[model samples]
Target: MKNYFKFKVLPYLLYLLINFLYFTNKKVFHHPKLKDDEAFIFVAWHGDLVSQPLNYFNKRPNGTVKTMISQSKDGEIITKVYSLFGIGAIRGSSSKGATKALISTIKEIKSGSDVAISPDGPRGPRHSFAGGVISIAQKSGAKIVILSSKPTKYWQFNSWDRFVLPKPFGRVDFYMSEPLDVTNLEFEEARDFVRNKMLLNIVS
Candidate 1:
């Protein structure tokens, strides 16, 4: 019963919830353009995943957006939800089969597909940066863009990452930082630069 609901019922509910929130809420976009054929990596905090996919796909419906999700139960639900939304999901995590996932993501990016990742997710210290994104950007020669969304009114779950749930009819403010070129920077430097930029955009 639990698995049925989680893998089936819950995804549809979330699909409806996201569609409602997306259509009803006032959405703000910043730095919305990316070359149609250029591949880029979007890095966002886990808390904003609820709305980020809708925001990205709605604007770039023709572009392919693939996200890295964990191999856990929650990831399964999220993968199903994303599929319903016409997005792609690669199941893995920083702690589990991340290398294979990263390799696959790099190939996708190299093929001119956009990829999204939550640097601090699947059990996070919250808002921290991981080097995996940097590796992907470097290897794939894709620019990294920091994305975030803030709602005027919302619920904050008391989970490890303090997950966010935007209220119906609320306004959501989306922020996108200037794209950073990670291909030239050393691994640590690229990671730090992205972390700071994401923190600043998301918080400010």
Candidate 2:
């Protein structure tokens, strides 16, 4: 029964839940004007994921968004949920098989697809930005933008990231940071800059 639910039930429920929330929520985008073909790497806290995919993609019609998902059982369910929304995934956690995932994601960006990374994800010391994203932006020559949000109502999961699921018809401020060219900043400096940008835009 557990296997049946894992393989047959979870993905459908998650897809229905995400779609329902996406349609019900009132979202406000405070983001820079984006170019359809411009490759970008988005930074998001692992917790703020529930409505992000639909909202972000709705604003950009031409590019695809890919993420690095782990190889675990849970990752499989999440990947299926993502595919339902037409989003793609590079299999592997940011920390475990990071080298391969990082390389793959950089290639996707250079090919004009947008990618999103939760700096503290797949397992976490939640909300703390990590260096992998800065490295990807540097190598891929893509702009890095943090996806910060404030939601009027939501449920927080007991998981490490305290993953947030925005409630139905809730108002969400989907404020994305202005694009930063971290390709040239010193490694640590770049990391700090992105982290600070994330901090400034997120509110309680």
Candidate 3:
């Protein structure tokens, strides 16, 4: 029932609020660290995902981008939202059957897809680290880039991750750090490195 509300009911109603505020306030900043003809992974703090995507995709150089998401009702709404922007979302996340999710992510990347992830999402202690992304990058040999956004004006949801919803036409500044190549380390070491990199990028 709760999932039903989050995915089906609330999002549509929130659309008016999002559209009104986002369209009305529209300043954005972007940074990129991409390579030509190379596949990569993008990691962003869960709290910054909403506005970060709005800022990053405009400069995606690559025409098609794919994202990984949870399979809950909220995930359904998110998938719909991504579709509206012509982005492809793969349904899976860490908290629920993480191994399976990682496998799916690996397959997608091996197929030459540029993927995005929330390393501390699908359920969270509000930005705490998780191992899935590190494992994915280590196995697939994809360079991971961490990015974060701070909205000049927005609402912060009281959820586990304090999700940010930017007001229409608001100014959102995105800070993107250089990519961290994970092809050199073992599983555990790579995981810790990626987690630390994400934390540093987000907390700045």
Candidate 4:
């Protein structure tokens, strides 16, 4: 039953869900500095993921958004869902196989693939930044672009990160900050700076 659901049912359901959300919601893009082929690390808070992924996939179909997902049962389901949209996933998390995932992310960025990360994801201290993203930016020479979304109306889950689900036909404001160059900053400083910038643009 688990195999059947994972391989068959889950992907189809997510495909429908993502398409439904994309077609119904009104999206406003704020990516002036981004180019057609330039690679960058996309960062957003985990709580806003319910809508952000779909928005990014629909809005930026020309760019690939590869993200780090954990190597766990839930991650399996999430990865399957992502594949339906042509998004790529690197399996690992801060707790397990994180080093490998980080290396893969850097390589992907250097190779011209855009990467997306929820700096406070897979579990969260809720908007607190993680150092891995900054490290990727510094090493890969990819600018970090902060993304945030606010749905005019939505549901909030009881989960640790207060996961959100925007209502169908509602308006979602998607904000993308100017690209940030983290090469010169120290690890801790870069993390804090990015976190504050994301917080200001993304509604919790």
Q: Which candidate wins on lDDT?
A: 1
Shift of residue 3 alpha carbon in model 1, Å: 1.6
- Candidate 3 regions exceeding 4 Å error are 1-20, 168-170, 201-204
Residue 22's C-alpha lDDT in candidate 4?
A: 57
What TM-score does each of the candidates earn?
A: 0.95, 0.93, 0.83, 0.92
Alpha-carbon lDDT, every model: 0.84, 0.81, 0.74, 0.81
lDDT of 4 at 123: 77
* 4-121: candidate 4 lDDT, tens digit per residue: 9886798788778767875798877765557768898888788886566665665577778898888988788878888777779998878889999999998898888999888887
- Candidate 3 per-residue lDDT over residues 37-156, each given as its tens digit: 676788887887776556556567455668888988778888877666667887888767567778877888888777889877878877777777877887898889787877677788
Candidate 2 local lDDT, residue 154: 82
In order of listing, the candidates' clash counts read 0, 0, 9, 0
Cα-based RMSD of candidate 3: 2.9
Pairs of residues clashing in candidate 1:
none
Candidate 1 RMSD to the correct structure: 1.5
Best by TM-score: 1
| Candidate 4 TM-score over all chains jointly | 0.92
Candidate 4: list runs displaced more than 4 Å: none
lDDT-superior candidate, 1 or 2: 1
